[model samples]
Target: MRLIIAIVSAISRGLGVIAALCLLSAVLSVSEMVFVRYVLGHSTIWQTEFTTYAIVAATFLGAPWVLIQRGHVNVDILQLAAGPRLRIAMEVLAALFSLLFVGLLAYAGWVHYEEAWSNNWTSETVWAVPLWMPLLPMPVGTIMLALQYVAEIMRLFVEPDAEDGASRNTLFSDTAEGTRP
Candidate 1:
């Protein structure tokens, strides 16, 4: 279990770097499209669709790391006001819920990927994206998400403060102090 969690965390972090690059690529593509359309008076259909997929890829790829790092925004007003033990209990419940939800998503995505594979589906767009391309990311991302939550739950028990000072927590701290954008 420890080895598995370590591997998952490493892979999640690597994917996050890829996702960052994809996000930059997506931004550049959109900027190019805008320049072409507004300044050059023409835009390629592929550029728009490709950019959209890049953004999606970036989002999916980054999701695991975000979850691992506990970067999701949480409504903690009530939890914050509650006692430490209550807050810990709430976090555990939330992590369990996340695990269940992501487990379902991963299973569904696997089924979808299998069907797509059997049918040899492809995108209807002129660029012809293989259906597996999008579907592959779904299961991969959701599984990563589930693993991260599992790791978090484990950390809550085994390594308290593993999630302390997480990225979102920092953001929330800034917001609480009226220093956030």
Candidate 2:
């Protein structure tokens, strides 16, 4: 169990790096597209499409990393107000619900990816990029997210006070004084 959790966390971090690369590539693609379209006075072909796909990939692929890091925005009014046991219960329920929804979403994404690959589907545009190239991230990333959820659940049961800084008895202790310019 410990080994599995470590592996999943490492994989999520690696995917985060991949997601950053996707964003970088998207930025570069857009820059090159602009140069070709305006500076060089030429029509663009694939850059726009590639940028869109890269961004989508980044969003899907980066999710697991976000989950592991607990870097997402939090609305902890209720959590802060709840008793310790209730707080854990709420978190478990939330994780379970998220796991179920993401599991179903991953399944749907897999079906779409399979269909695209099997049918040799391509974009209607002149570039005619294969649809599976973009669709693959949807299932792959969602599955990773599901695995992260499982690891989270395991960790929660094993160390009930670990998540969201609950061990410290406050989710946002450092930010107790609101940030303001």
Candidate 3:
């Protein structure tokens, strides 16, 4: 279980780095486009499409890393009020729910990718980029997110007493004042 979690974490971190690079590339591309269009008085073609796809890809690719890091926003008032057992139960339920939701999304995304790939679909733009290129990240990210959910569920069972700083501060502690532990 620990090995599985470690591997998943490593993969998520790698994807996160790729996502960051995608974002940087998008920014640079857009800047170049602007410079070419306005400064050089030239028309741009691919930058808009490339930047859009890059941003979307970055969002999907980075989601699993956010989940693994507990960076997603959560209103944890109920968690703060719950007892230890109830908290554990709630965490399990949340993880299960996330797994189900993300799993379904991953499945759907794969189906979409398959259809796009088989049909040889392309964007109706000047660039005519392959649809599968952008679609690939959706399933990949959601699958990683589902795995992260599994790891969360496993952790709840394996180390019930373990309290990470994010959970301790955001869920249980008073945010206005300071952390509990």
Order of models, best lDDT first = 2, 3, 1
Q: After the best TM-score superposition of candidate 2, give how far the Cα of residue 11 lies from its true spot, in angstroms.
A: 0.5
Question: By lDDT, is 2 or 3 better?
Answer: 2
Model 3, position 76, has a per-residue lDDT of 84
Q: Per-residue error at 101 for model 2, in Å? A: 0.7
* Ranked by TM-score, top first: 3, 2, 1
**Please, what is the TM-score per model?**
0.78, 0.86, 0.87
Q: Write the per-residue lDDT of candidate 1 for residues 28-87, one digit (tens) a residue.
A: 988888898999998567778778778877887789899777688788898788644556
Backbone collisions counted per model:
0, 0, 0
| C-alpha RMSD of candidate 3 | 6.0
Q: How far off is residue 89 in model 2, in Å?
A: 1.2
Best by TM-score: 3
RMSD of 1: 8.2
For model 2, residues 95-115, the per-residue Cα lDDT tens digits are 899899999999999999999
